[model samples]
Structure formats: C-alpha cells, structure tokens
Target: MNKLRLIEMIFFLFCSLLSASQKPNILFIIADDLKASVLGTYGDKVCKTPNIDKLAEQSLVFDRAYCQGVVCGPSRTSFMHSRYRGSMGTNLAEHFKNNGWYTARVGKIYHMRVPYDIINGTDGQDIASSWTERFNSSGREAHTPGDYECLNLNIFTDKLEHRESTKMPNRMFVSVSYEGDGSDQPDYKSASKTIALLNEHKDKPFFIATGLVRPHYPNVAPEQYFTPYPWEKIKLPTIPENDLSDIPNLGKSKIMNTNNSIGKYIDNQKKMWSAYYATVQFMDEQVGRILDELERLGLKENTAIVFLSDHGYHLGEHGFWQKENLHEEVTRVPLMVYLPGIKAGRTSSITELVDIYPSLTELLGIETPQEVQGKSFLPLFEQKNKTIRTEALSLLTNGKGYSIRTKDNTYMRYKDNSEELYDMNKDPKQFNNLAKNPEYSQLLKNLRSQLDLRLKQEAVTIPQKIKKVMIYT
Candidate 1:
C-alpha cells in the first residue's frame, strides 16, 4: 500500500472508533400508577409539578401513549420484553448489558407490589440476569407511623391487635400525609442511589433505570406535598348517575365494588384525590433531583432520558379507585423521551409501551432481538407529525378482555361476547357508550375486525410438551 493511502485508511478507522466510544448513555425513569392527565404539561390545572413540567418542555411528549397491560406485572413484563406478556422471555436491561453498555436497576423496575415488597425488600419477579447491579430502597416509608387514621382503617407504627391489615379493601380509597422530612422515604433513597450510580458511570456508556413507587397505594407523602392541594380546592371527578348501567358485565367485573361505600362520602372522596395528587408531586420531586444530578455531572447533553409509568391510575374516575380495568384512565400512561439534538415538543401520534424497545435500539444503533413484537417509532423523533401505528392495544383479565385505541375512538371486547365502543372526539370522558346504538354498528364491526387481527398478530404461543419415546433411541 502507498504511504498516503495507508494513512488515509488509518485516519478513517480512528474516527469511527471515536464516534463509537462517544455513544450516548440512557437514563430510564419509570413511575408507578402515574396517569398522563395529572401533569402540568398534560393540561392538569391543579397539580404543581414544575420539575416534571420542565422535563416535558424538553421532551417529545407522547400525548396518547398506552400500556400493553392494565396492571403492573403484565404491563411491565410486556414493555421490558418489547412484546406482549408471555410472548417471549426477554429482558430489556439484559439486552443492553449483553451489548456493550453497563446496566443497573434501582427500586421497583419490575412488578413489586407496593408496601408489601417495599416493607420486606423483596425481589418481586425482577429479571435477575438483567442488571449488572441492583438495589432496593428500604426505608421508614414502608413502615407507617402508628398515629395515622383513615376512614377505613388506622395505621399504627406499632402493630395493634384488632386493627385491620393495610391491604384491606376500604383502605385503598384513603391517603395518609406523613408530617416529617421525606429523607427516609424509599423513593428518596432510590433517587440518592441513582445519582451516585450516575456519577460512578458518567464516563462509561450505561443504562440506569430508576423506579419510583408512590401514587400507587397507601397514598402517603411528605406533609409539604399535601399542603399545596387543600381539601377545599380538590375537585372530585364528575360521575353521571347510573354510570355502570350501560357497561357490560365483563367491564363491570373489573371495577372495585368495595370502594363504592367509600365513594358515597363526598369529603372522603376529596381527601383521597388530594392524597393521590400529593403523592404524585412527591414522586416528581425525586425525578427532578435525579435529573438535576445528571445535569450537574455534565452528562445531560449526551444521555437519552426516558420517563413513563408502568400503567395509568384511577382516582374516582368511572367510580373506580385503582387499576385493573380496560378504560382509558387505567390504560393510557404518560410517556416522554428526550434525545439530544432533537427538537422537543408534543406529538399526538398514538404510541405503545412496546414501541419503546425498538425505538431505543434504533436510536443507539443496537441490534434488536427478533422476538420483539413492537415496531420502531424512531421516525417520529425526526418527523413529529408521523403516525407509527393505527391503534394501540391493551390486554386485561388474562386476555379475556381487550381494548383497542385508535385516533378517533376506543373499542373494548369481552370474552362473554359483550362489547363497548366510544367516540373519543365527541366524549373524551367516555361518559356515553355508543356500542348498542344502531347507527354505529358498522363502525363497531370494523373495529372488532381490526382488534382481532392485531391480537392475532401479537399473540404469544405457549410451549407444548415434548414426546418421550424418541429420547430413548
């Protein structure tokens, strides 16, 4: 080879190595039971979430992001694998670890039932092979102060005889605001640990995921968070009389019937709403602290940050207190992605949690596993107006009930042959069910066909038993 030709080749090789080494790190932050409508950027008039709102300003906010499952375990398992739950055993962090990046998890990345898992510091269905290192936050928040009282039950710091367990049905509708500094909270600890990890891994390409477990249950937060949302200012969701009359049997089955008694008391309802909002703001503070640390470390410009919830939450919406429904309140979550150098704004294009995997892989130039069922939405980053999928699907009741959300409507089908259809544009609150109307029969038929096709395309196959006779030979 000539001297000039060899030197040119060497220069190109060095540039390629430099570019590969400078790949951006990924910081994934997920919240538990956080709905999209409660944030300041999502048209929330009451909640004060300045830090989260700032992040939203610099992120490509997905206005219609839906989860694959209505509950935690299924929704998290679905998105982590980039496929429907039970489709294939794939771990998102493990995938990144297998590639060149170092992966770590802090707090509840998987399905850890709050208060139970947090109290015991248990590894609830966590993918062991996914993380290079993992930490669970165990703090005073898990063990409640004894003096707190709710309409349903009382939490005694010291275990009391005859006092009901915190998991009682009636307790789900109550919220407790602790009076003290939040330094001892598990979420606070998780944020501290995440910041340390970021500082430690700042020089290397790392994938650090932090999960905040608040606003999920036991609706407890620091007193400061609750001060902003006074009971007088709390607005209860408007529920029409006989709201459940038109709902199908399958749809009604998911509703928490036990909370109906608590819902009757208007003051109790307002207090519960206030508590939920307070907890959300507390969680947002932790998010801000972590983001601030990332910026302080000078890694903000090169790091790709993704913020989302495992699934949405319900606070008296549809007369429901918690998740486990196929309704929009429980299925649609807040999702935001901030990529360096990309124009930040909002996009109404419907997106799914499963789409997260392929989008990240494509953005980082990593090879995605063949088992992933979601399509890459990286195109939406460049062209905010583009539509990736026509509908977002969510499974409920072990796949017995399913919901399909399109641009203009939401259609739900139950295993018992009952159905529900809503025109989102006309009735955003989903107050009026249009399924039984004769005028919408054709539209319902088309939606059902589309839902069936989508489900078939995303179905996961169960493994069959192997024959024993052939092994003997």
Candidate 2:
C-alpha cells in the first residue's frame, strides 16, 4: 500500500476507536416510595443517608423533580415508556435492548406491591421483553417468622397463623425491626446481584437498572438500622389543627384519614417513623454497595448513573401517611444524574421522571424513539441556569385528579371540578388554599388552560397489544 493511504487508514481507525470508547454505560437506580425531604442530601435532619448523600456530591441534584403519577404502577409505567400516564409504548429498557445494549433489571422496577410479590419472587407489572435478564430478591422480610410485631394491624405474627390472609387497609402503617442483619433482605440481595452484573459486563456497553425496595410499606429493616433513630428521639411532622378545613371534599378524601387508628398512640407513630427511616438508611447502604462496586471495577467514569424514586412518599405530611395525593410531599421526588464530564451541582429547574428517557439517550448519543413525549434536559447539564420546562404535571387516581407545579405555585383541579391553588412562594408547606380568592381568578384560569393543553397533548389511545404488555400480575 502507498504511504499516504496507510496514514489515512490509521487516522480513520483511530477516530472509530475514540467514538466507540465514548459510548457510555448506563446505570439507572430507582427506589420505591422514597421522598425527597427525607434524605440528608435533600436537607432532611432525621434520616442519616450517608451513601446517597455521597452520591449527590458527585451528581447533579435536581431540586424540583416531580413524578408523572402519584402511585407506583402508573408512575413506573409513564417513566419507563417516556410518556404520560395514559400513553402506551415499550419501556426504556426494551428500547436499549433493541439498540444493541445489554439491559437487565434486578428487584422491583415496575409496580409489585412489596412483601406479596417479594414472597412469590414474581414480576408484578414488569415488561418481560424489556430485559435481557432479570432477578427478583426473595427474603425473610416477605414472610416474617412469628417474632415480628406489626403495629399497623395491631397483631404480632407470633399470635397469628397464615399471615398472608391477614386483611388490613391498603394504607395501613406497618413496621418491624428484624433480629438478623440485612444480609437476608431482598434489597441486600439485589445490590449483590447488581454488583455481580457490573463485574460480568464491565467490558461491554450495557444498561443496568437496580430497583431498591425499601422505605416502602410494611417498613421493615435490620435491627442495626433501627438503633440509629430511637422512637423517643423521632420527631413527629408538624401539622396544623384545621389542616383539612380549607380543602374541598374531593381533596379531603385523598388525604390519609386512617391515621386515627394509630394517632392516639404516639409511641406507635414513632415506631412507624423509626422503621421508615431505618429502611431508608438500609436502602442507602445497598446503593452504596452497588456504587462502590462500580468504582472498584473501574466502570465509574464511563457509566452514567441516574438515581431517583418512582414517586414521593408522605410520612405524616398534610395529615397523610402514604402516597396517592397531589400534594407537594407526594409529587416531589429526589433525582440526581451523574454523567462522566458534567459538573456536579444542584439545579432548581422543574423536571419530570419521564424526562429521564430522553436525557439519557441524548447524553449517550443514542437515537430516542419518536414516540417519546418527554423533552431532554441535557442542556441543563452544561448550563444549570437554563430552564427546559415551565411547569410539571402529576396525575393522581388515574386522572381523577391532577396537579400542576410551577416555580411559584401549585394548582390542583379534581375531576369533580373542585380546585386548589397554593402560593408556593408564601406557603411552601401548601397549607393555605387560594383557589376561592377573587383576586387570583385570572392566574387560576391561565394555569387551568395550560394544564388542559398538556393533557390533550399527552393523551393517547392504548393499543390492545400494548395494553396486554403493560398488564402486571
């Protein structure tokens, strides 16, 4: 070959190698029912989440990230498909699988009501086609042997047989601190499995999603986790006496009213809070384990990590204990992204969970599917001052109620036409409602118009085949 031709060939090969090496691995970590306010990184005073807080330091923390849905199934479905709640399509993992990347999910990625699905080691609403491989962690927490005390149900397992058939409210407060270490927990297994996957796929371009189930219902954690926060030191959330008085009847129904069962018993309430916080810390340790493995395997630099919750949880906020309301506590989630070269800082820009699909695709130079409805916030990674969205919308009760959160306000319009407006600038806690005030009539109208337009744009007719794929047992 001629000398000039050889030089050109070497240059072309070099460019190809550089481009191939630039393609990043994706590590998506999602937690269940973990709210933003409870984490140390998000300014929580009670819970000690050293691992997640460490992650926040090396990541770009999102200050106002909202989920598309209030509940697990719909919220997971929306973000996974990169569309609104009612839209239909394949999930993010499946899209990656089709694009020549190995994708895997460990633990609960879709909506599996914990303990039930954990016991069976089954996929609840997961899209089987999305994953190249999947693993479910079955632990002792799923079926606690006769020693644990369940405060919410007012039953000790030792006193009862056949715990599976025990009937309780869906929002019943349940908690237990097990006698053993966290090694037997499903989340612990999930972290170990994820670490194994990382070691196995270190050389290949891959997408690994680890879903940590903790701080969810039946709030159970190891005894060591519970020891950090004693019940006596646990602080109750400050609540106004007439908190629900201004709320409409529709809104009142959405708030958790069953707290009366455990309200009078302050010790029980403290125990529940302690359990939830302990679970958060336990989950944080699992996350630390996975992240440590990534760094140890030398995959940290090339892999992009996106950490967030499916939706926010309410721990006695707004007189509500569990999620399924359009309030700020239930809608706002903790979202942090770590790209290779992006500067680490917090951004106040409003964002949605659905935005994750496009942002990751854009960052990795992957072609996002045309059906995706979320806008990529990749620009914010470079310029944190820039704003990609004016507001974020969250659907509740399958669209029976919805909320629109803007920088200065949060507006909710129920299916019954009852309305609520909170001036976030003045009432950050969302205690006072301004919807009935005559002075803000025009402002309310404009927000309503924007919400209606958004709903129209996101609406999609679900195909039967897609619907079947979305159905989870």
Candidate 3:
C-alpha cells in the first residue's frame, strides 16, 4: 500500500479504539403504552415478569416516573429532544452521534402510531436526525394471521384470514393470539434486528435503542405466552360505579364511554386484561433475549441499560381503556437504569421522561447541552433521597390539561376550568376528588398556584433554525 493510505488507515483505527475505550455503550429499551402498575417489580400483584424483574434486581428502579405529554407523539418528542413539546433542540441519539458515537434505533423509538403505523409499515412522525441508522419493523398488526377478536364488540376474525381493511378503528382494541412462535411480530423482529446490530457494532462506542411494541394495540403474542393468562385467571379490581363520575368530560378517554353492549362489559374487560398480560409477558421475554446476547458478547459490563415505557396506559381503570387522559394510570410509567458499577436500588423520587437525556449525559461524563430542560437525577444512585425536583409536571397536548405531582398530592387542572385533587399519599387509587370538598380548600389553592408558576417557568422560545416538527396525529 502507498504510505499516505497506510497512514490514514492507522489514524482511523486509532480514533475508533480511542472512542471505544473512553465511552460506554447505551442500550435503551422502551416498551409501548405500558403502565408501571402491571410490572412485577412495580408491586403488580398478578403479572409474572421474570426477565424484567430480574433486570430490576441489577438496576435502579424509579417508582414515581412520569411522562410530560398525555399521548405518544408529544410525549416522545418531548423526551427525545430533552425539552418540552413546543421547544426545539437536538434529540438524544443525534447528540451522541454528533459526538462521534455510532447511534442506531430499532423499532418504535420516537412517536409512531400503534396499529396504523405498524400496519402501514411507516415511520409516523419520526425525527430523521436522531440516529445513524433507524429501522421500522412492520407486522400485519391486527391482521397478523392470528385468532383476532374484538372483545367489546364480540367481533371475531378467523386465524386464516387477513384484515379486510387497515382503517378499522376497533383495531386498537382488538387482541390476537398468534398461531406461531411470534417471529413475525414487530417486537420480535425488532429484538432480532437489535441483536444483529449489537453483534455488528460491538466494537464501537454506540447508542442503541430498542423500542418494543407490545401490550400496545392488537395485543399480539404467541399462543404459548397466552396460556398463562387465561380469561378465567384474568383479574381486574372491582371499582365503584361512581369511580369515574368525578372526572371531568375532557379528562376521560374515549373508551370510558364507548357504545359497547353492557352485557359484555365485564367479559370484555377480562379478555382485554388477559391479552395485555400475555403481551407483556412476551415483551419481557424479548428483553431477556437481548440481555443474554449482550452478556454473551461481553458487552454488559461496558454498557448502560435503560428500560422504560413511553407513558403509562389505563388497564380498565375507572372504565378507561387507553392513554391520552391525564390520570395516574396514564401518566406514571416505569423507569429502570443499570449503570455498570452502581448497586441495585429503588426510589420513589419523582422523575420525568425528559430527565433521561441529561441523566445519561451526566452518567457518562458528557457535557449536557444548555438547551436541555431536564434535571439530572444521577445522585440518586448512591443517595436515594436526593431531591432532583420537588415536583413532577405533566400535561396534555396544547396545554389542554396540566398536572402537578408532589410528594403528598396530585392536582390536575383541565382547560374547561374543572379541577381534580387527590391526596396521593392517602388516596393512591384517586377515588375521592377533594376539589369539590370545602375541607381541603386551602390545599387546593396552594396547588393551583404551584401549577401556574410551574407552567410559566417551563414555557420557552424555540430555536428558529429547527430542522423538523411533527404534528401529533
């Protein structure tokens, strides 16, 4: 070889080795539409998630982790950029990629719509700059050649049939018991692709994100996984008939007042629960497979694993079915971080999804960008009681709703001038709305003031040279 060519090759190899030695690989695995309440590590009395629970044993589990947006698009955009939905900034993976790290994403990272995006095989509102390489796993979704059924409507599709139309609205509520081992599922493909990428990029300093779409919509999982969650075994708490009465009209999800037959309500609830549990179990298995691969490749010791959900979902809570409502079930998500040398611990410290960006940068000794709005909770690894923030703030799209979650209370305000206040410490279930009660008048006043001030502080001007903006569909 010529002298110049040999010199260039040597220089490139040295740079690669230097980056690998100085930086840690990041494995960020986030589940779709998953609530913290269903996980075994999060005090779930029913679900058996051996893989994720085992991960919790080696990680720092945050019990009070919340999301900024009530729905997927805004919530994801908010965290991916490490800023509020209306603000403009560089996304998490893009930041690392710009700093000479190989960043890639597999499956649903940003804000892909569940069944629609999965069925059409499109990247719904995905930001292009976030990764060096990005992948989207397309499955038939509701038409995944399975035993499909719409529990509420008693509509059933044969296992041998494909969907008549992808535009079916009820597709989101349908559940499918796949006939095969689930290799055709999006999440399965995502995991397999993620494993492949890990092997190919094992030598480089990398930021790999694995987004698993399960327990999301169409609730497709293999028949073997469904065996553990039979309808007879599916259990839902008996909530009061008046449980949803106090919630304002704008604060309730569309599923809360569906037109389904009353006779099939309880049966449908159980069926939905059964499918969700089965899908969650299936998702956990994928996590186990990826972790095993990371260990087999000897990457575990040099990698930081972060497992979380985009936002929580309502599993028949107060007759609510999906997300988009600013309630505890839809706001509080699961967050677990596994840094190499830190011992496993659990904390109730209030955390938000936006915090992940800054925290990851801090843990890896990287300089956080000034535009990032999140506060780092890195101190909580050793000092569990460290106060990262006195309160966590969450909101609905376009500021339709605002919630302030403090240690003692959860105060929610809607655009219609209606309010709901629950003593989070004393009333975890939120059955009682103290907003109408005169006894807690003073407490309500203080919370409202806090929310107002917090909102003003969070509002910021977006940079004029923003590359792209995705409207939440």
Candidate 4:
C-alpha cells in the first residue's frame, strides 16, 4: 500500500473510535398537526403548554420552520428522508442505525393514518430500516365510553348515538371528554414506553424517535384536561363571509376535513376551540412526563433533544378547517433543538423540516450523503440572523403543484397553470390574491422562474417497474 493511503486509513480508524465513544444520545420528539402559533412559547395567550414552554426556554427555537408537505403522510416522509417527495434516500434514523448506533421508534414517526391506524394498533407505511425496534400506541378513539358530543348535529350524550354509523365513525367532528387519568390515551402510552426504552438502552449510543399524536383529530382527552379550558372562555378566529371567493379551486381542500360540518359552526365554535385546546394541553403533559424521566436518569446533559411537528394545522384561518393548503397556517411548523454544548437561542431565519437530518449530522460531525438536498443550518445556532436559504418550498397534495415562501411574499402554482400570489407584508391573513393584478407581474415572473429552476434540478423518483434491464430471456 502507498504511504499516504496508510495514513488516511489510520486517521479514519481514529475518527470511528472517537465517535463511538463520545457521541451523545439523540432524543427526537415529533407532534402531529401542531401549528407554530398555538404554543405558549410561540405567542399563544390562551393555550396551556407549560412543559413544551419549559423545553423551549432551554432550546434553540426556529421561528419560521416550514414543512415540505402539508398533510401527515407526505410531510413526515419528506422530512424523515431529508429529501423532497419526488426524491428518496436513506432516512435519518436508518442513517444512524447504519453507523452502529442503536435507533428505535416509539410511535407515529412515519405516516400513520389518524384514528384508523391507532385503532388497528398498526402503522403499515413505517420503514423498517429506520429502527432497531418499534412499538405502536393504540386506543379506541371515539368508541371509548365518554361524554360524546356531535356539536354540528347538536347531539350531546354520554354515549355516541346509534345513528352514527360504524363505518367512518368520528371521521368528522366528535369531541369526547373521557373519564380517566389520561393514562389510556395513545400519547401517554407512547411517553411511558419511551421512558421504558430509555431505561433499557441507556448504556448504548441511541437515536430514539418518539412521535406523539395529539391535537390531530377527534379532539379526545381526559376530563381533567378539559377542565382547564372552558367553552365560554374560548375565542374563535375571525371568519369573514365569502372568504373563499378570492381563493382558486386548487387552493381549497377537495377531500373531507376532520372538522368540516354542514352548518351550525356558529353555536359550536367556542366548544370546538375549547376541545382543541384541551387536546394540545394533554399532549404537552405527556412531553413533561418524558422530560422528567430523562432528567431523572441523569441523561439530560448528554442527550440532544429535538421537538418538531410534521406540519402546521389550520384553526379556521381563511375559512380553512384543516391542513392540505399552502397557506402559512398549514405550512409553518414548530421546531426547536437542544444540544448539550451549544447555548440555547432562537432564530427568525427561514428553515425547512428537511433541513433537520442534515443539521443533526453536521452538528455531530458525522459524514452525510451527497444526495441529501437539505442544507445544514447548525451555524444558525451561533448566528441567529444568518439565513441558509432565501425561500422554503412546500408540496401541496392532490394535483395542486407547489408553493414557495420567501421573506416578503408567497407564490403558489397549480397543475392547471393557474397561480395565486400574496403580498405577505400587506395581507398576513392572505385574504387578497394579487396574482391577477398587472402591478405585480414582474414579481410573479421571478418567483415562477425560481420554482421552475428548483423542479429541473430535483431528481425524480419514478417507479422501478418501468426501468430498463438487460434482456435475460
């Protein structure tokens, strides 16, 4: 062997040994349908999230973290892969597992259909390569004996009425205040199981991802959780008449929303808000439970903690009931990281969820793949004002193309060649669509060009069935 090659091999061996001994444990916590605006640390006055607020105090909070996809499945898949929808690569957990690290998943890490998947106690889309071990937290969603209320139908009963069919039950709105200590809920079980796993794998270098599902659907929580949030005290967001007039058909949700109802949203608006807040509070408490266990085990100092949501939710913003839109309410997610050596800080710099995998690898001094598209923004922890990217791109589901968000404006384009442009500074609510106006024609063209360039650069992920192979027959 050459002298230079021998020296390189020695150095590589040194790094591998050093990393094996010194790398800290990774604790990744993700939430479902959690919007950035609703958290107490993120400036919500009414919602109670004391545990998450405490973590935020000791973490580096990203104020403008956007998700790549708006819905649960696509959004989770995009971030975990550190790539766009059309692009695929090894997932974050799988990457660590490949590096001789003990990685595990304790809940909804990958796509799990809400309520349905929980009811079945199975997640079919989960990538097995991502974990050394995995577990699911199951619960009887709406069927659990409780104080059930179909607010839209003006039906209030301790038990769900017989008229509600078994098929697609609780697919729409159903708020249930159950009689329990909240231990039976899926999120609580997940927290408890995570605590158990920490005890089991405390000695090894581990990458543990616990995805907590709450504030996502059915709005079910313990009766005690509901006590804090009163219906009379809840304040609903302002909904202007004909709010969907300016929005193109592609911008609206074609599928059914969990909160969508025929009418009578007026009388139940306050109750709906109260129920949603209760679910969030319940979710926050589970986080506290996990945090307490971590600190008790003396692993807090050496554990790097990350908290994020798959995507943001719409609480009646722009007359939108749920996610699947490209608006700020749907795309902007809550993101925070707590590393042991770095001092906690917050930044307003634009970031995407896909950047998370790259950032973690960079911070840990690990070698990352060249195919990964996300830019490492660990430097943002040191310099809060620095921006790694000018715009964040998010994919819209159905046939609706995509949306790109910048500091000043948001540009959205549909598959049908239609567009919607909003001047974010003037109309933060996004009630007015300025794409038709001739005054902003130049600005629209520039954004369109940017989107076009991004699409051209991205490698497509076509099915392998059609790929050509040598004719062996």
**Model 1: ten consecutive residues of lowest lDDT:** 464-473
Over 23-96, each residue of candidate 2 has an lDDT whose tens digit, in order, gives 56889999999999999999998899999999999988999999987878888888998877544665789988
The CA lDDT at 157 in model 2 is 56
lDDT of 3 at 11: 33
Pick by TM-score: 3 or 4, better one: 3
Any idea what lDDT model 2 has?
A: 0.79
Error of 4 at 96 (Å): 0.6
Q: Which of 1 and 3 is the better model by lDDT?
A: 3
Q: Can you list the residue pairs that collide in candidate 2?
A: none
Q: Tell me the spans in candidate 4 whose CA falls farther than 4 Å from its real position.
A: 1-20, 160-170, 255-262, 459-473
TM-score of candidate 3 on Cα atoms, chains taken together:
0.92
Number of the predicted model whose lDDT against the real structure is largest:
3
In order, the Cα lDDT scores of the candidates are: 0.79, 0.79, 0.81, 0.79
What does candidate 1's lDDT look like per residue over 442-472, in tens digits?
9999999999898778854333431111100
Cα misplacement distance, residue 334 of candidate 3 (Å): 0.3
Error of 3 at 134 (Å): 1.4
Residue 395 of model 1: what lDDT?
83
Note the clash tally of each candidate: 2, 0, 0, 0
Cα miss at 324, model 1 (Å)? 0.8
27-146 per-residue lDDT for model 4 (tens digits)? 999998889899999999989999999999999999888998788877787788776673366789998999877999988988887777787899647888889999999987776679
Candidate 3 displacement at residue 420 in angstroms: 0.2
* Residue pairs of candidate 1 with colliding backbone atoms: 146-156, 146-157
User: Worst ten-residue run, lDDT, model 3?
Assistant: 6-15
The candidate maximizing TM-score is 3
